[model samples]
Each structure stands twice: as structure tokens, then as C-alpha cells.
Target: SRHAQFAKPHSLWLNDPDSEQDTDEDDSDEVEQIDQDEIFDLIRSISDPEHRSMTLEQLAVVSAPQITFNSKVPDRVTVEFTPTVPHCGMSTFIGLSIRVRLLRSLPERYKIDIRVKPGSHESEHALNKQLNDKERVAAALENPALLEVLEQCLSTAGRST
Candidate 1:
């Protein structure tokens, strides 16, 4: 039931002949424009790291999705996720994957803020702070050399020791 709901298409305007005729062309055009919320929703469909086929929604990692954009402040998006267990080291990696998916899917203008949902073993505030540390994370994300290192590590792990 929940999976069906998440999988449903979010139309720009619900089809109602009467409503469509009542609105001006400009108004209808504005309504069709996709915003950050829509972008986030698309990114949220990305599957969890541990689970191959099932999406984050299916795995129930994602909670409430919020997006804010303002002229005075940088655009910020907050996503809440829960790990399979309290002590999962892969939680941070999963969070980073979600962040990368968001960044790649969204326009570069947005600044993402990802956090683990409260009531978990990990500190939500601390995780949030780590995710928000752009300077440190950006260096790793931007460096091709670092990605190569990560790929090597992954390849090595896949082989018998």
C-alpha cells in the first residue's frame, strides 16, 4: 500500500476539464514548473546501499522530506534516514550516497543537509554536522584521486583475502 503511494506519479495538475479551463495559460505554465521538492522526491527513489533493488522508501530509510529556498539564505534541503541497526558503520556511507544523489539530481544552487533520524544509537546532531561540513567533504567528493582510492579498496574487498 505504501509502496504504491510512493510509486504514484505526482502530476503537475490533476486533470479536471473545468479547472483547466478556468486557469490562465501563464498560471498553468507556472504550475507545471518543477521545484526542489519534486527534485528531492526523485532522488529519494534511489535505493539503499545494502539493499540492491528496493528503494529507500521501500526500505523505510527516508522520513519527511523538506526543501527551502530563499533569496536571503542559501537553499537547504533536509532528509531523515534510519539505519538497519544502531551500530552500522555503513550508515554514514549510505547518507553520503543519498547526498550525492541529491546533488547530482538537483541544480547546483542547493545546499543539502542530511541527518539520521532521532531515536537511533548515533547522535543526529553530530551526523548532521558531519554532513554539513562542505569544505572537508567537498575535497574528497571533488578529487578524482580519492575516488580511485575508494574504487581500489572496493575491488580489493571483493576478492578473497
Candidate 2:
């Protein structure tokens, strides 16, 4: 129910004995190929920040077509989401919830690229930069307050619509 413990667990990934074997099995022997539908299934049910009862899918903020897998690269997945309005303020939380869900579900080798659907938000560029940058993402995860809220949003990952 609460898989948020692994949100930014770099050290745990490295040090956990159980995870090391899991990682080896997941990382080397074979590559896990994911499709748009599978990726969508992973994130589509995330709880919307503004509406507790609505999933991102229910709100039409995200869809399977908005996700793309890089067949050429194989390890990169890009996900785009349209906010409720051009200037919707819950963009970061929604983006973070998507990223966190993927990070928790996907193998370590996959590089997730998350962004606001182009032109869907007034500050699309800035929001995209903050969401994609490793530094900013790590910084955000460090805040206890934000993490609590993010955990709440992500807590409904698969249990909802």
C-alpha cells in the first residue's frame, strides 16, 4: 500500500542484500521491455493532488498514448501529462507522483523522462526542467513536508481507477 519508502533510495538499493540479488536479476541477464499500455497502467491510477477521489486517468491528465518508449535506446521512457488547466498549480505534484510510481515499479536501468505535455501549462519549460533535473528532484525528495504529501498522492497508485 505504501511503497513510498523507496522513493529516492540510492543507498538502500546499493546496500540491501535482498535488493542486490533482485537488481542483478533485473539489471544484467535481460532487459525488461515495457510498452505504452504497461507504463500507463503503472501511472494512470495515481491519485490527483487536487482531487482526492479522482485518478489521473479519471481526470484525463494522463493517458496511454501520452507515454512513449524509446525502442532504439530501449532504456528510456518518456511520459507526458496534461494538467487540468494551462496554469494548474498541481503540476509538480502530479509529475512527481508519476515519476515516483515509475521509479518504484521499473528496473534500475530504465531512465524515465517526465514532462508537462507541451503547451499544457503556462510555465511548462520551467516545470519540465525542475521535474527532469536530477538535482532538483533529489532536493524535492529531501523535504519531509513535500515527501509526506507526495507519499499521500502516490499511496493510491494501483488501488484506484
In order of appearance, the predictions have TM-scores of: 0.56, 0.78
* CA lDDT of each prediction against the hidden true structure: 0.49, 0.71
lDDT of 1 by residue, 34-142 (tens): 4655645544455444444455656666644544444475456566677667665445555665666565545666667777877763556666676667765676465
For all candidates, what are the clash counts? Answer: 0, 0
Which candidate gets the maximum lDDT versus the true structure?
2
TM-score top scorer: 2
